[model samples]
Target: MNFELFIARGILSKDKNNFSRPIVRISIISISLGLAVMILSLAITTGFKDAISQKVIGFGSHIKITSFDLNKSFESSPVDMQQPFYPSLADSTGIRHIQVFATKSGLVKSEDQIQGIVMKGIWSDFDRSFFAKNIVEGDLITIDPEKRTNDILISKRIADKLEFNL
Candidate 1:
């Protein structure tokens, strides 16, 4: 009744030189396939977890309080940055920080060159750590809440194509 005991006692031992039994071959193949699948699943899952973690961290914070007009469109509805929950969120536990943001997209034309670009506006409280890490060139200048700023950060690729000199 105990197959494991028989195998352990060498009573049902398999001959290594002779693999003529169909059941033995099938069992070995099945075990190998199972192990391969498990290993592959583990590897893929770990890789996915790592990639998703990096993207979530790299793209900035976990939650964004954008407008409800986000119906699969890039354009977001305008909303007042000041909200009642702002005070509660700041006072609540688990929340690291809160920042305000706005974005608009349009086409820029310069003589013969025309390019589409999206402009993102962030409040003075915005975290610049992510931007700092990704900035290929140019020192990041903080947007003074009161002062008018024309300062903009662009990707190196865009700068080169736009023939930007600074």
Candidate 2:
């Protein structure tokens, strides 16, 4: 056998009552536990990342196309929906869908309380699955392409703070 292997075998042999046996065993166990903790940490971190990403993406899509204006406000500049690339984006290799959205910064008033909020406007083509899954109390808003609805959906935290309900 090789010199290293021979020496290691001698050191690790069961019949030997050498001091190195306990040291080697402790070192092996510590290394194993450290590796296990690292693996578990990595797994937990990956799971958290995926979950948080899904939640964020649920609120909005992965990629957004907006006007290149230098406005530093919550309101985004308008992009034309009739662009030639809009229709063909779905057929592209990686893109699954595309939708238009608009946001406006406004204030909500109830009794004497007023809270500033950003309102997101969505149309019939917008995805409602995320809101549907996360709606804690009220039902999803029905969007009609022909007629406009005054219904609005707000988060539970905002509802509690503003003392509002469905």
Question: Which candidate number has the best lDDT?
Answer: 2
Query: How well is each residue in 1-166 modelled by candidate 2, as lDDT tens digits?
Result: 8999998798899888877898998998999999999999999999999999999988878898889888988899888888988778888998766788999999988986888889999888887778888889978889989998988988887888899866
Q: In model 1, what lDDT does residue 45 have?
A: 100
Positional deviation of residue 6's Cα in model 1 after best superposition, in angstroms = 4.8
Candidate 2 structure lDDT: 0.88
Candidate 1 lDDT over 54-163, as tens digits, reads 76776556787777863675668877867787788887888877877887787656556677888777779988888777787789978888998877777676677677
**Cα displacement (Å) at residue 134, model 1:** 2.7
**What TM-score would you give candidate 2 relative to the actual structure?**
0.85
Segments of candidate 2 deviating more than 4 angstroms:
1-7, 14-17
TM-scores of the candidates are 0.64, 0.85
In model 1, state the lDDT of residue 64: 76
RMSD, model 2, all Cα superposed? 2.3
